[model samples]
Target: MIEKHTSNNGLRIVLENIPAVRSVTIGIWILTGSRNETNLNNGISHFLEHMFFKGTNTRSPQDIAEEFDSIGGQVNAFTSKEYTCLFAKVLDTHKEYALEILADMFFHSSFDELEMEREKKVIYEEIKMYEDTPDDIVHDLLAQASYGGHPLGYPILGTEEHLKGFNADTLRNYMKEQYIPENVVISVAGNTDDSFIGKIENYFGSYNAEYKPSNIVRPTFLANTIERNKDTEQAHLCLGYDGLPVGHENTYSLIIMNNVLGGSMSSRLFQEVREKQGLAYSVFSYHSSFLDNGLLTIYAGTGKDQLPLLRDTIDKTVETLIKSGLTDKELTNSKEQLKGNLMLSLESTNSRMSRNGRNEMLLNRHRTLDEMISEIDAVSHDSIQKVIEKLFNQSSSTALIAPDTSG
Candidate 1:
């Protein structure tokens, strides 16, 4: 059973007790990320995520690491476009100690000036690393082309100039505004007892309860194309279209459509573009659903001479899917594929913790495995057709990074 509790101070707690398991995964989710950022502070959320592990008032960075390692546990965190998460996995017996350490970092991080400056250089190198990898940078470029001036378009890793400008106060101000109790969710999955609930409440109950209204303007889709000439051997391409937001009714149908289109090894794009015609080495499609909006993207990497053919092939694939739609056999196979993957992923305690945390943070509700499977099963061929028509038939933006031929 999944249990939920909301403290008076507005920290939402969710727990799924798996009595058979000897371990637990706990996640602290903050509902703010790049979308909440201004152009001047585009990557503050991600930067803060990094700083949280640097040290705290009572614990040095080494102490934090040593404690987790001593217990044979793991601690990590990540920042996404919509939220940031700090999480740990430990034996069920060690959960209390793990939570204490996490709470210490959460409530008492001491973003030392020296560490801040050093991390800035580290992040700058991270940004340059992405710049050198065209396959990775092409998606960021496509996002910029698709969303234009919107905050969603900004890379999660802010520019080098922006990183250089960020100081301790800049990060603290952003955290002060965004990281309040009401904007946080704590999720735990695996072996747990009733006492665990009270413990979590006691740990988080004193936080300030505050909610700030976000005035993020919805991004408009711009079907523009951008090309960057780099000194690389292969051309990397990304094609993006507008997609539905989280919890949209048609999202399941769109997922099914995506699978049949280009989501897997047996997908049309992979089979046709790579296996049959030998036009490209890699080709796939993905859908990203956010709070208020989403993006459907297709990516392919191939030699410069094959770029035009690859683009045309992908375009034709979309045109064909929009025109012909998926057959019943195709829909059935895709649904089973999605269901198998979903069930397999849930076998991990960490995956369950992440699912519970993200659902509560993003949707404020929990969806049972049965509920999700039913939704997937209920998707009809016509529903998928409609999704393909609605999303893929629309205008799309393209981004290409190719070797610079000009002298």
Candidate 2:
């Protein structure tokens, strides 16, 4: 059973207790990211994530990393367009220490100017790294193509122009606007105590400051193609279409639909395009959904010569899905695979903690494994067809990054 509680300050807490687990994983989820940012303050969420690890008021940077390591705990954090999370996995005996470090980092961050300036350079290097990599560049292009100029579609890593001007004030003020009690969820899984939750509540209860504003202008469906010429061995391609939001009931149907399309090694896209035709090497499909919008994307990498054949194969597969749809057996098997993956991953405390926190942040509620199993099992072919029709039955925006044409 998954237990849930709403604190007086409007913080949501979800707990999952499983016996036979020797470790505990906990996460602090702040429900703000690039999607909530404007052109002026974009990437500040990701920036702040880096700064928190630089040092906190109570701990040095090395202290933070070493303390966790000394206790054999795993700690890390990441930011996305919709959320930022800090997670830790530690032996059950060290649960309180992990929670203490997490609370300290959350509320007492110094955001020191020296560290701030250094981390900016680090992030700048990271930006360079991503820009130099063709595969990374392609996904960003796909987002821009699918959502146009909306904040939802903007690159999570703010542009070079935006990052250059981003300073400590830019980050602190953005944090002030976005990191509020009303927009936070904390989760812990494994052998943990109810009283430990109270300690968390006590620490976070005093955080009364109203956080950053969220004037998100949702992205609209855009139809366009963007091609970036690059010098690379393999051409990277990404095509995206409109999809359903996370909270929609059709979400499960779309999950099933995506799986039947290109989700597995045995998937039609893989079998026909890679195994039989001997195309380049990689092919996959995925769905990215938010509270108000979604995107369905298919990605492939092949030589420029194989582009036409690859495109035709993808188009034919989609057209076939639209016509005949998926079978009962395929749908059943896909759901079982998905369910199995979820269950299998739960064997790790870190996975459970991250999964619980993210789901609560996304859905604003706690759901048992049984609830998810039922939801996936209840998905039907007709329902999936309707979802597919709504999501991918039209023209989509494409982003292609291919090698220099002279080759």
Candidate 3:
């Protein structure tokens, strides 16, 4: 079970105690990411995440590293389109120590000028590395095709020009604007009791930032096509369709439908595009849900010369699924697989912390295990058909990266 508390300043804390495990995982979830940025500050959220580890007021980067290593704990952070998380997993005996170091990194990072410049050079190479991976970058291109000039279309890694402009002031100002109490959640899981919530509050509570009304604009779905001819040996293609937002009524149905389409090894896309025709080595699909919107993405890579055949096969597979709908076997198997995945994830404290943190951050509510299992089991063919129709009813945005053989 999970216990919830709200700080006086509106920061929320969620704790789950699993007495059987001697490990604990703590996560600090911030509801600000690339979608919260502007064109000029496209990747500041991700950059700021990197900066938190560079140094704090009292701990050098090396000191922070050695502290975790000394205690056999792990710490990491990630930036996404809509949120950022800095998390640590440590033995139960070291939870309080881990929390102190994390709080230090969060509140007192110096953002030194030298450290910022060094990280900028590292990010420059990171950008170049991303550019060189055609298959990886094809998805970013799909975002550009789908949302055009919206912040949602911007890459999480801002351009070098923008990176060069970031300084201590730039980061501090952005944090002041977006990292308000109402936009943060502290989640902890495993072997910890309710008393830990008070400990969390001591470190995170009472801090105040000027509340600003949200000016987030809901983005429109566009079906633009983007093609970048590169020097890669294989062609990478992605197709995007309009999807339901987080917590939409038909989300479970959509999940089952997507699993049947391209989400797994036995999925139609995998069977038709790869197993039967030997078209590509990797082909899959997934759904990404945002605050007010969602996107379903299908991706595949094939030999440059077989691009036409690969695309045709993928199109035919999708067409067949939409027209005929899912089989009884597909529906039953997908539901069971999803239920198993959900249950298995609870075996680890890290997964529990992440699940609770994300649910609290996005939904502002939590459902019991039985309730979730019942919902998954309740998925029906008719419901899945509705989601299929809703997802594929519109034209799809497309992106492609292939060799520039035409020249």
**TM-score of every model?**
0.98, 0.96, 0.99
Error of 2 at 104 (Å): 1.3
Model 1: residues >4 Å from true position, as ranges? 405-407
lDDT scores of the candidates, listed in order: 0.90, 0.85, 0.94
Model 3 scores worst on lDDT over the 10 consecutive residues at 313-322
Rank order by lDDT, top first?
A: 3, 1, 2
Cα RMSD (Å) between model 2 and the true structure?
A: 1.6
Model 1 lDDT per residue over 1-407, tens place: 78999999888999999999999999999998888898899888989999998899889889999999999999999988889999999999999999999999988999998988888889999999999999999998999999887888889988888888888889888888999898899999999976798999888977784578877787888898989999898999999999999888998899888887789988999999999989888889999999888899999999988888898999999988888888879889999999999999888999999999988988898788899999999999778877877786678999999987565
Which digits, one per residue and each the tens of the lDDT, describe model 3 over residues 255-283? 98999999999999999989999999999
lDDT of 2 by residue, 141-243 (tens): 9988887778877777786678778776777777677788879999989997677778788877657666445666667789789998888888898989899
136, model 3: CA deviation in Å? 0.9
Which residue pairs collide, candidate 2? 176-212, 177-211, 177-212, 178-212
Model 2 whole-model lDDT (C-alpha atoms):
0.85
Candidate 3 residues lying further than 4 Å off, grouped into runs, are none
lDDT, residue 314, candidate 2: 91
Question: How much does candidate 2 score in TM-score?
Answer: 0.96
